[model samples]
Target: MPTKTKAKSLPDGQLDHHAINEFKDVPIRATIEENKKIMEELFKDSSDIVLREFDIENGPKAMLCYVDGMVTTSAVDDALKALMILEGNAFSIDRITEQTLPVTQASKIQFYKELLTNLLSGDSVLFVDEQDTAVCLGLRGGIRRSVSEPETETVVRGPREGFNEHLRTNTSLLRSKIKSPRLKLKSFVIGTETNTNVVLAYMAGIVNPKLLEEAEKRISRIHIDGVLESGYIEEFIQDQGYSPFPQVQTTERPDTVAAGLLEGRIAIMVDGTPFALLAPFGFWQWLQASEDYYERFMATTLLRWLRLGSLFVALLAPAIYIAVSTFHPEMIPTNLLLSIAASREAIPFPAVVEALIMELSFEALREAGVRLPKIVGQAVSILGALVVGQAAVQAGIVSAAMVIVVSMTGIASFTLPRYNAAIAIRMLRFPIMILASIFGLLGIIIGVMVVVGHLAKLTTFGIPYLAPVTPVDMSDMKDVMVRAPWWKMKKRPKYMGTSNVRRQRPEPEQ
Candidate 1:
């Protein structure tokens, strides 16, 4: 897709709008020299591209062109050996492809651009002297990252295997969990220069037709220079493109994706990225984890409440502390207020400034921990927080009460299952803290109103971002605010509009 970046646009500023070039329209020449001329011109100064010309026994002159490290050398050697030993009197593309190739996958490519796409994707192309088409051998093999347990979405009692960067492997992982024949995996080529492979996985009958169409339409509308990862695809297809809250759910765990698909959601998987994007997702889904489904329902139910509480604390702890300590001292208990006032006796900054200073410093230390080496990052975050909080308090820059509030808030944030959700709450803290300083508890109320309004207004592909709660679905309350027992969860999410609504049969007698 070298033409991706250079693709000429129409007068209205649309991509791929130019007339087809004569080069792509040109058929492979009967003579080997003419074809070789075009090939050499296309790959002018490339050193890694290998082009081998040889005589085929009882066949026309032939050439094999492919990238160096993409294909196995021994496979190519064996293919040559097999081609040369054949005693056929005539060259036929079908016969050659069906009989001679030692590999499993092969196809006849007709156009120049198609051949280029295949060769670039790590397949070897065999060009016969007088044939107008080329044989594409599936020889893609090289070093790839091995599949292992995902570091971020780890679970104690579920499948430990996580998705790797390979597209086929990820799809296979989904299929293994969902053994139904209706599971569909469709491919789309995105990014002009990278030509990355993106797959859309969904169940045919279970997925909503309108939702699937919308997702596919959004993906087709993206004509970027390159798509290096699934994040690239995620941004392109998300509903609220500018919203801080994630409209798309990202997960590296295979079980998570499989669960989403079973509930009638479509997944987008990009090559060279372990993370996959799930569509038509809601905010509550982020609070749910893989372990929630695997663990006992009672335990998961309790954990959900803890996560919900943590989310509020992460977002409002600092703001509330500032309001209560500064302008609403009567709201606090007398003893706590005295303790907070004593701690702030020598501090020179106002409540808002004090909170912001500590919050920003803690956030910086956290970022340093993440950006540093893993072993060093853990030590830096832990020790940096301890040292900075203690030193700031002793130096009389911040109160001990403020330090405790910030620490508790940080702990609450880490309790979130999804990093993206936690990040949204984390980033929103500063604005609310400023609001708290300006108007005390009233400012906090205004900020909460604004956030709730935005959340209610937001939608992910026509499904409410704050689904079940905002739409006020009475039946969905079982799973949204709390985890219902396995047998109690008798139907799929109402928004899915799936044909088969019953998720399971009635529970049998004990």
Candidate 2:
């Protein structure tokens, strides 16, 4: 059972505590008044809790306990109407649930822990005057956002539907994609106070047993007070703590989660959050887009290469500028060198300092835009960059050449499909920029080497981070470097260690 440790002081200066041990093993009392008093004590400060006391016709007394606005009022009324007009005097909880109440999803609860769980989960519980057991009705209701296109991962030639905050809705979306009995969604209740519902989704036969076991072990080890989002689970279950690169991929699209499951990856979904976590993520996947599988292989391959190029530009553009202008000016062509020199003539700051100022400003503006309303954000980010860059150049605070470099870098970062991957690159850019300032091009080279080495050493759930590329698995490269045509790509990733390697049988001769 879950635990709650917080203590609230009563009006008489006594500590009113609901510790786990106090009620974790406590069973319901036979008297309705006793049960009602215990429940009232547990929910003292809560005003939304409703304890509607009513009498059954020719039968014993009963009380309905539920949170207002959380349960269906019509259903609760119908249940009361049915119970109040009962024909017999029998008043057992089992008899009322099985033969009397009109509620279809009613179940008997014996302990307070189960009672509290069902009550908080938008269900209505009933307490009879002489019964120890209570009936719990599934009447979950309240306002929830409808499904819509994901804000972070918008695609043109794919399913427009995205996962909503509702856990059942998200699971249904995945079920719609991969309609197979083998697709299993095992549930777990985590967090002591929140009791957040988490599901581990995977293709039963395709996922390796060891990988699944490890994933479960890691997740089950998380002992926390509450979990509000899937990111909380992601942080706890990831293999490496300090790695900037995300070991588990987060996506708001159900199709993406389904795709990962088909490839022998496990997806972790948390309640009250739309984002799902995909484990055993690879380096190349950072550049991969969901649209890749929907379009022609050739076009998708070209787009992948474009994103790869942008990744380099975002990572190296500013550092290259800093290195060349500060130390390798001779490497520049005569005309371009003269133009750059003239642009920086009145600028007081060096190339490195100028680049830092522009980059930091751009980052600040991007963050501000994201935090603000959508309509206003776009305008602020776009106009802020243009106005600030031009003003800095005109005021001789930074060179025009530096502005172009910073703008290019910012644009390149935007091209990355994954937000977390883009953030990692953006963060690394500063260190590389500082290195270039101190040791010129050699420092940039050293920084790049260190990054590459760290990535090579990283792993996601025992699978190498740079799979297929670093380990040189040729069969898996079809989807890495270039997404091979669907028919031609006949096998799942070998690195996943799945027994079912064949995604499709070979095509017959033309």
Candidate 3:
């Protein structure tokens, strides 16, 4: 005999528990009805929830359960029509079992847990009364952005379709790209209250077991109540808790994720977020873009170097200016120095004060441009920069040379691939500028050394943040400083813990 207990505190107040002894040696047909009764009890209070009850004529009566708005109506309708109208004439329980349902025009999916998992995933479940099993029909729906190019990662050449919020759709997009059986996806639910789904994707046999284990362990330790975005999980699971630089990179492009997986990096996909996280990221990783892979190797390499140069200019240009004007006058050309002195002769503020004022104003204008509506933002930024620069110079509050230097520095910082990394540079600029104004070139060197020391201490998933450079891997440098030809990139990134090193066969001598 089976004992059932009703749940009082649950939302439905109908959750039922059956003693294991009652189900022992029981027929599957009997077990299914018992399971249905339990589910009915569990979901009683969810009135909007839909559960379709139908029969296979002379065979068995069954039910389909799904959340109202989470499933496609058309899909469920078609499935019901197929079961009731198409197969209604033939009503044998054996005809509709998992083994026979596909032949009888219904998709047959086995495994009890899989059925429950699919049902909970917004798919309609078909429960045949006489049979002990159920079939979960794949029909998911929810409000999601239409397929469009990613705003953050716009490409002049390449696939423009970005990942959408829908997890299944995103998985499908990835699957469509890499049809190999080597591609593996493992799912876990995080968050005690939210129960948000987190998926780990990679190429099995290629990915290092150690890396996978570490990633899994970190994710499992997350004790948060909610995981609303991929970033939430990233922050919780990143190796270093103090570094401002991002240890995990996020991308909206399926191609990027697929490429990363092929190279043995783990891709984490959170349920509600379109952005996926990739771990074991390096400082230089932020500087590379998907466009780099799409364009010619030479063009890509040149653009990368240009970005690197721009980064230096962004970080060091203002400090250099302050140092030269305050203490290093000899480093400046005699004519340029004379001209700079002539302009500064009328300025009321010191070199540091002028630099601070201009930099702060530039940052404020940039923020305004970002927050303002798209139609007016560009115009506002351009006009604001021109008016502020001209007014300050004309008022004798700042030198014309200072305005040019600050403007150039601002523009240089904008060239960075990652916005966060750019902001980090922007923040460090002020301290370096102040130090340079106080101690000239010596202060600048001290600031650089401090920044480098901090970077050396930083780690991303146990791998040094400045890997291949600080550690100095000659082979990895082929891809880091320059965009190597695809063939030359035969091995996976050493930091990512990929078991399989080679991606392709080596070229034979011609």
Give lDDT tens digits, candidate 2, residues 85-132: 877666666678788888778899887878887788789998888888
TM-score of each: 0.93, 0.95, 0.82
> Which pairs clash inside model 1?
none
What lDDT tens digits, residue by residue, belong to model 1 across residues 239-288? 78889999888899889999998898999999889999998778898779
Q: On a 0 to 100 scale, what is the lDDT of residue 299 in model 2? A: 95
Number of the predicted model whose TM-score against the real structure is largest? 2
lDDT of 3 by residue, 253-320 (tens): 99999888887888999888889888778788867888888888999999999999999899999899
Give the Cα-based TM-score of candidate 3 against the true structure.
0.82
The per-model lDDT (C-alpha) reads 0.86, 0.89, 0.79
Clash pairs, candidate 3, are: 14-41, 14-42, 15-41, 28-132
Against the hidden true structure, what lDDT does model 3 obtain?
A: 0.79
Model 1: lDDT to the true structure:
0.86
Which of candidates 1 and 2 is the stronger one according to TM-score?
Answer: 2
Backbone-clash count (model 1):
0
Q: Is candidate 2 or candidate 3 better by TM-score?
A: 2
